[model samples]
Target: MGIVSTYLRAFNTNKLDPYPVEILKRVDKPTTVVLESEIPRLDERESGFNRAHRGDFGPHLTRERQRFVGKHPLSAALGNMQFTLAHVVDGIVAQEKAPLPNDPALMARHIKETAYFLRADIVAVSELPSYAVYSHSMATGEPVELNHKYAISIIVDQDWKTAEATVGNDWISNSMSFVAYSTSGFIACILADYIRRLGYPARAHHARNYQVVIPPILLKAGIGEMCRIGDIVLNPFLGPRFKAAVVTTDLPLAVDKPIDFGLQDFCSKCGKCARYCPTGSISFGEKVTRNGYEKWPNDMEKCTRGRVGNTKGSGCGVCVAVCSWNKPYTPFHRLVQWSMRNIPVARRFAVWGDDLLGYGQPKLKNKWWLDLEEVDGKLIVPTQAGQRGNHRRKQA
Candidate 1:
């Protein structure tokens, strides 16, 4: 076998029964996905930021994203990390180059191994889809010009312990998102720089910055399946509790395929995220065709408002907190996960059991951060602390 094939064989050949087994159901190609062959490239300018910029959701989101995130110490720390890394996203290519094989498969394997070594939870590669690139930059309002041959997607899980304790949209909400966002962004930046040093054109697309829409590339790259929680992809291991960053490059590399861990069926039966969504944003009804792809229609306006206008916290993650797939990999959770993937009937039980066991409720005693909010211009003790505040559901 080639070096790449050997590496992938070992990677996909885990003895953990039905763990990688569940995830590595490789086929000649991705399951026939419903896609708009000529979908319009998304415009980041017209996104929720547009509404935020228009003073629709709230003023804080428009003036600076930090207004919401800087309310808490932990969230502020994570947000600051992004600020530090935001400047060097694109950098100089080194004149001296490292000797490496020209084989795409070998290169792909090496890149994946590199990302894993850098603490990326999951990584996938795919040919860059035309529709995946954003139509324009929200930063400069110019058409984003990117024609990379491959996309390297990196995913990072938000710390589950924090989510386990949080009431979803608590003081820790933006921190959870930023923690994953910053981590994945860090990985992507280094990976892209590495590729450029090898005499290739590479650009890191991250949380605070991007020239592409990630979910589409992620869907095509086999990292996860499309989720009902809007356009985000869901990894079987991390579910919706992760954020992603991508390195788009012209470096030749082998690619992965879209995954199918029975998320569509599970999401259909268990509309729990929609049921428990605080802003009535996620659709509890059937999926529909929008601009070509069949997906659950999300009210980004309501979702954005819920996140920006949260009285008790900086942002929302109720959907992530309550996803049936968002469980830790304990033996019990593993068995349940296997059953849900293999035994179709178990999906209903899994969904119902998540609530019966009171899995979505917060653990207030686990709260450890300060109860501060940035009001007007200064930080002060908020009247409603995230730990003591009310959520859509009570604790178990």
Candidate 2:
């Protein structure tokens, strides 16, 4: 057993390397998709949840946002942690700049390595587009003026194990999101502070505090491509199964170009996300031009209602749960992922095979979490239909 343990540890271990997976190392420049655009700067207040908070979506949705945290115990706990961290996202930059290398390439590599050392799953750098910055803050309704030259995007994977165990809009839904949200936010905060210590202006952008829009940054940083799941960017590896945090910095670094993994074609062929979306929010039709980019546009009001005002669960992730791209990285799954990227015919067949193989259904035997909800100030087993959000009845 000792010898086997040693062999396994030595198989492909890199003490200095961050990624244990091989696919990440193969990702490089020269993006395949050509995005034509005239994107305008957006206000942070226009976001779905923010709209819910401001009663723009509806008064009922505003009430939903007020009680959003306490709907699920685990989600509430995680939300509190991230909200606390938001208070420390910005700080004073040091007066003197630290001595550093002249090469942007070297600096880029070093910064990425630092993120990896801090447990970031994946990191990419991009020249921050001015349009990505929000025109005003949602929290304070004040003008946002971020002029950072480079943006460091970091991704944290939401555990696939938990995703496999239950329905998309169950007690575990928001917990899946907050797990990635808090972890990525923690890493961004520390990375930003480290840059400030080096005499660079930096600010962390996470769930609780974001002054910048993420989709454009994700595209420009080679992180992923915009998918049919509205503005959500899907990575070749992580799919729509992860959350991201960003650090906007004046620190010099080499930026990566956008990547194309044939997601646009694949998403077009596979409508599994649309088929399984609880509120029928995802579009099952062709791409259309909205916000200067030609992509599938979803109903934001319905989607927000499905999430923030969900009576069936804490929040909905049916789209993420059923996406063809969301799969475990087993040997067979990896082979399928490669074919989906390279072979056009395979993309069509993979979609059919996913449904045939029952890839989207819940595996109840794997359930590990309690079906508990927090009401007022106590945690209790949700026995009634109303308490459990009447999700089973809704699905019927």
Best by lDDT: 2
Which residue pairs overlap in candidate 2's backbone?
none
Off by over 4 Å in 2: 1-37, 384-396
Model 2, 1-396: lDDT tens per residue?
A: 132332353356554333332233234532333343566789999988888988987788898898887688889899989999888789999999999998998998899889888888889899998888999998899999998999999899998887777688888888899999999999999999999999999999999999999988887888888888888888887789999999999999988777767787898787777777767777888888766667788999889988997765778788787788888866577678778876799999998899899887877789888788777778777763112111222121
Model 1 over residues 263-352: C-alpha lDDT tens digits?
A: 888888887788778888888777887865777889998888777777888788988887888888675776787677667999999988
Q: What is the lDDT of candidate 1?
A: 0.79
